[model samples]
Target: MNVIHAENIIAGELNEFEQAIRLLKRLHECKARQYLDSWCKRGEAGVYHNVMRKLDRMGNIYQPYADHETEITDWFPLVDCIADTAVYNLKWLGRMGQWHPEALASLTAYVCEQERLQAKEK
Candidate 1:
């Protein structure tokens, strides 16, 4: 999943939440769904489920990974969704004054390149 690459991406400058989201998006795009699902599962009884519930209680949104059995067979849509969500979240953070706009724009451009690479596979 190249999780380390994802972790190193933020350059240790962004907020923790931003870093986490970037890592999550990278994992999603890299087809590390199982890893993500596993990551979310670490509490008491059903820790992951409990964490999700707690996040829900706090109004923090968490996008659940697609269940392979019920998920669409196509990969493009999934990649597109991941890219779109990351870009959207980046823009949102910028708009909310949580991140520098110029920095966000640069990140978006890099993510766009990732999108282009994904598109070429199809």
Candidate 2:
């Protein structure tokens, strides 16, 4: 998914951290589906398992944010974790020529914009 789609999901009305996670989850699902389709078409279904594993790893990184006790004060650290995982996932996808550069760029831009906006509130 692109930044516009992410923005639409966020609707600029929720907590910034929550919105960011939601967008990331959506993008992860989209990327997973893209990889699945590409691998299937190539008759390399075995490789799809690797993609799922990476996605699962990303999900593990997101677990803390999924916890109800996570505070707003934890936003930056959580975002950093997500950024790291996303970069790792993108790099592997790139090696396989399955990466969506535009989507990655858009998501990065959106995250930066959110960070800026949230900083202004403090």
Candidate 3:
């Protein structure tokens, strides 16, 4: 996993972290049920558990930022954690041959948007 140090985060970059959290929450709520249903029907509950686990990890990583609104330093790890979880979840879904088009699109869009923001920073 790539670690993003707090000192490396630029001013205003925390907005991207906030956006990522929102996107992850939206993706989880929108797709978790469908994924759970599909995985359960296919007797692949383990895969659903993995996906939800990543989402839970993301929530845990973001909780600090959500709780301390003024503490932008905490956003550094949150950004990397969100990125890692999103990428892992997408890859896991793909590997399981359970990719939902809409969910994939949302995840892809989040990655692309994050990349764009990072590029602008550089």
Candidate 4:
């Protein structure tokens, strides 16, 4: 468990909601550090070219990384897309009203199990 989880656990226990939230937070931290953050340091134009190469058909959405100095311009849509993606997740919480407790318990357990498997692989 990370500091986030350790700080939240009280008397060897955490409420389902808090546990699930912390688990997802941990998952995000892992992905951002191991994968997402490295995208900008890879390939020809780095993150820009890597993503645009795959999104060529969409003329409006994709732009070639011509000027490496202004790479931040190419990364702008990513921030916009993140906000859109965050809003899209509202449906899940909206649907899990009455089943939140058990659902969160399962979510936390599933994340912990996956982390264990991933760590063992490493």
Which one is best on TM-score?
A: 3
lDDT of each: 0.51, 0.58, 0.61, 0.50
The 10-residue segment with the lowest total lDDT in model 1: 59-68
Error of 4 at 101 (Å): 1.0
Tens digits of per-residue lDDT, candidate 3, 15-53, equal 766645555656556666566444344344555675577
Model 4 lDDT at residue 47? 39
**Candidate 3: misplaced stretches above 4 Å?**
1-44, 96-122
TM-score (all chains, Cα) for each model? 0.26, 0.29, 0.35, 0.27
Quantify how close model 4 is to the true structure by its C-alpha RMSD in Å.
Answer: 15.4
Residues 5-58, candidate 1: write the lDDT tens digits.
Answer: 453665656766676677666655565444444422432234434434444533
**Per-residue lDDT for 1-40 in model 4, tens only?**
3333355456347666666555556555666566654544
Count of backbone collisions within predicted model 3:
0
Residue ranges of candidate 4 with Cα displaced over 4 Å: 1-85, 88-99
Query: Which tens-of-lDDT digit does each residue in 3-97 have in candidate 2?
Result: 33453664556666667666666755777666644534533344455556556765665666678655356455545555546644444545444
Q: How close to the true structure is residue 17 of candidate 1, measured as C-alpha lDDT?
A: 66
Between candidates 2 and 3, which one is better according to lDDT? 3
